[model samples]
Target: MQAYQVAELTPGLGADERREFRDRALSSARNPSQFTQLREIEGYGEARLSLIERYLLQGTPDASALAAREAVALSAQASQYAKAMEGRYVAALLLMRRVLLGTALVTGLLSVTSALRALLLWRSEMDRRARREARQREALSLASHELRRPLQSLLLASDLLRHAETQEQRTHLLALIEDGAAQLASRADLTRLNDLYLDVTLRPRAQDLRPLLERFAAPRVELSLPLEPLVWPVDGDRLRQIVENLVENALKYTDGPVEVALREVGSQPEVTVRDHGSGLSDTLHGQVFLPYDQGPRGLRGGQGLGLPLVRRYARAHGGDVTLAAAPGGGLQATVRLGQPAGTRAETQAAGGAGLLQARSDAG
Candidate 1:
C-alpha cells in the first residue's frame, strides 16, 4: 500500500492523505516485543536480526525487501538449533532410563542372595540342635537300662540274706549284695563323670608317674617308664584315672599284652597305651570320643564314657589326648601333658632302658 501510494501521488496531493500514509507505515513496522522474544533465544542469528531491524526503520521499498529476507534466514537458523537440541534431550532420557533399570536389577539380586544365605544358616543350626537332643535322649535311655539290672540283683540278694540258714549261706548272700552294690556305684560314677570333672578344679602338684603306672601293671599289661622318676606336675587322682581307663580299654579288646609307654616328646610328658588287637575304624575313632557313643562295638559291658573323660581330664591339665592306629595293628591312645619350664631333662631322659627296668619291676 505504501508503494502504490508513492506511485499515484502528485506534487498537489492533500495534507490529509500524506498524514494517513505516514500513520499506516509506522503501524506496519516491527513491534518492540518481537525483537525482545527473538533476542531471548540462545543462537537466533543476532547480527542478521539487528540488520533487519535497522532496515525496517529506514521506511524505503528496497530496505523493506532486504529486512524481509534477513527475517526468513533468522527463522531457519532458529529451527535448525531447535531440532539439534530436541535430539540431544531424547538421547539423555534414554540413558537415564537404562541406569535406573540396572540399579533396580542389582538391588533385587542382593536382597535375594541375603535371604537365601540366612535361610541356609538357620536350617543348619536347627539340624545340629536336633541331633544333639536326640543323642541326649539315647544316653538317658541307656543309663536307665544299665542301672536296672544291678538294682534288681541287690533286691534279690537282700531278701536272700534275711532267710540265710548257715554261715556259708550268709556269706554268699552278702557277697552277692556287695557285688551288686559295687556295680551300681561304678555305673553311677561313670554316668556323672562329665559333670564331676567339669566342677572339680585340677589340683596339680609335682608327682612321680612310675608308681602310678606300676599299680596298673598286670600279667596282660606291660609298662615302659623312666627308672629315675617320671616326675611331672599333675593331678594325681585324675592322672591315675587317665592311665586306668586307657589300660582297661586296651585290655577289653585285645588278648595280647597291652603296652604302656611313658616318655617325653618336645618338653612334654606323653603316655601312650597300645593294644595288639583289632583297632577301631577311622569313622568309629571319632565316635568313641563322644559321651555314651560306643561306635560299632555298642556297649561291651562297659560305659562308653571313658575316652571322653580321658580327654576332658587331659585338657583340664592343659593337655590333649589323641588316638591313632598302633604300628602292630591296634589302637594307640596317647595322653599328652603340657609341661612347665625346667622339665625337659626329666622328659628327654626317658631312654630305651626304661623298658627293661619297667619289666623287671613288674616281674
Candidate 2:
C-alpha cells in the first residue's frame, strides 16, 4: 500500500525534530506506499517534497522545468565527485604498474650481473688450475731430464767398478760415482730452491751484510764491502745461498778477479757481484733470470738454474736481483732486499710467482 512521503511540517517542531522527519522521508523513498501516504498529508509544504511532487508526480510543465534544472545541477556535482574518485583509482593503478616494472627490471639486471660474475670467476679458477698443472708437468720433465745423465753415469760406473782390472780403474770409477752423486745433490738443491721461493713464512732478521759477503769470497776475489756495517734484514741461510750463487756464477763464467760489494741503497740493502770479463749483451741480461735460460756466453754444459734461483730468492725477500754490464767490462749482479712493509705489496704484484699468487689474489 502507498504512504504519504512528505517531511512533517510542524510550526512547533524543533530543528532536531525536523531533521529526524526528513531522514524518515529519504529512508522510505524506495517504497511508493510511504510516499503515497505522505503526499496526502493535509497542509505539508516542505521544499524538497514540493520539488519531488512537481517533477515526478504532478508533471506540470513549469514546475517540472524548475525541478529538472535543480536535478541536473545536483547530478553534475555528484558526477564530479565520482570522476575524482575514478581519476584517483587510475593514478593508483599506473603507480602500481610502474613499481612492478621497476622491480622486475632491477631484479633482472641483478640476476644477469650475478651470473656473469660467477662465470668469470669460474673461468679464472679453471685457467689458474690449468697453468698450475702445466707447471707441474714441466717441473717433472726438467727433473727427469736432469736426473737421467747422472743416473746413467752411476749405473755405468757401478758395472765398471764390479769388473775392474786394476786399482787405477777402480779409482776412476769411484770418481765417476762421486760426480754422479754431486749431480744428484745439485738436483736436490734445485728442489729446495723452488721451495724457498714459494715459502711465504720466511722471516728476515737483522744481519751484518759485510761478514756474510766476506765469508763467501775467495782470497783472490776483490771485496769492496762498506766500512760501516751494512746491517739489513735478511734470512741467513738464503743470504748465504744468494752470496754463494752470485760469487760462484761470477768466478765460473769470467777469467778476471770477481768483486763483491755490499752497500745500503735507499731502504734496500744492495749486494753487487762484479767480474771483469766480457759481459752479456743487453737482450741476454733480461733472460738470464729466466729458468733454464743461459746467455750466449754460457754455451758450455751447465744447468742454467743459478741466476733464476738468485732472482727468485731475491724477489721472495720482497726485493729483486738484476744483471747489468759492469763499467770497464764484465757483468754486475746486484741484489736488493726490501724493507718488510714494502714486501707485502710487492708480493701482491708478483704475477703468479710462487704460492703467494693464490693467497694474495684471495686477499
Candidate 3:
C-alpha cells in the first residue's frame, strides 16, 4: 500500500487528511499484530498510530504526532503564499510592458514633430532667399535706368560738340559734353555692379591677398604687408571695393596718415585699415556699417554708402569686418577671410607666375 492508497482508504480525509488517516488506521486495530500490519502500509507511521490510539483510548497523544500535523499545516500555508506571489509577479510584468509601450509611442511622436519643424524651417529659408533675389534684381533695374539716361545725354552732347561751327561755341559745347561725360562715368554701371554682387554672393574666386592689397595701396596712403603671401577664395571686385571704400573713408575722416596692412591670422587672411584721426564714438561703432548710417557728428559730405558697402562685400566673401580703436587712438577696420589650401611650393609649381603677374596688374 502507498500514500495514495492510504489517502483513498481514509474516511473523511478532506479535513485534516493526514491526521484522519492516522486516526482511522489506529482505531480499527484489534491487537499489536494488526497495528504492525497497519504500520507496514505506506504513510502509516507506527509512532503516529500509537499516539492516536493513546489519544483516543487512553487520552494521551504524543508530542511528535502534534508536530507532524503542524508541519503539514505550515506546508499548505506556504503553497498558498507561493501562488499569491506568482500572481503578483505576472501583474508587475504586464504593467512594465505597458509603460515601455507608452514610452516608445511618445518617442516616435517627438521624432515626427521634430522632422516636421525642420521641413517648415527649410521652406521658410527658401522663401526668404527667393524674396531677396527678387529685390536685388529690382534694385539693379532701377540703377540701370538711372545710369542710362545720363550716358545717353553725354553721347548726344559729344556728337553736337563735334559738329559745332564757331570755335567759341564749340569750346562751350565741349565743356558741357565733358561735364556730362564725367557725371556719367562717376556713376557705376548697373550690369558691372550686379555682376560683382553676384560673384560675391554666389561663386567666389580664388585671389592672392598680397597682390590685391598691393593694388589698392595708393601713394597717398601708407601700406604694410607680411613676408609671406596670404591667399583665399573671394570675390575679387567686391574685395577691391571694400578696400577702396575703407581707404576713402579713412581719407575723409582724417587729414592725417592712413595705414593698411594684410597678414595671416592663424588659418585666415586678415586685412586691417587704420586711420589716425578723431576715433569713432562708442555709440557709433556698431551703427556705422548699417546702410545710410552716418556717424555721431553726422559727417554730411557722403551719402553714407561707404561703410555699408564694405560690410556687405565682406559678408559676401564669407568674412566679417569689425571697427575698433586703433593703438594710436584712431579707427581700425579689420576684415577676416578663410585661407586658401596650398603650400608655397605647390602654388609656385602650378603656373602661379602668370597669376602673380595678373595679380600685380590688378593690384
RMSD after Cα superposition, model 3: 21.6
Q: Give a tens-digit lDDT track for model 3, residues 186-206.
A: 445455555443333434555
Sequence-dependent TM-score of model 1: 0.43
**C-alpha TM-scores of all predictions:** 0.43, 0.44, 0.44
- Runs off by more than 4 Å, candidate 2: 1-194, 199-201, 340-363
Candidates' RMSD to native: 22.9, 22.3, 21.6
Residue pairs that clash (backbone atoms under 3 angstroms), model 1: none
Whole-model lDDT values for every prediction: 0.70, 0.65, 0.64
Off by over 4 Å in 3: 1-203, 339-363
TM-score, candidate number 3: 0.44
Models sorted by TM-score, best on top: 2, 3, 1
lDDT of 2 by residue, 14-108 (tens): 75665564444334433546433333331222234445443544434454455545444544545555676689999989986775675575567
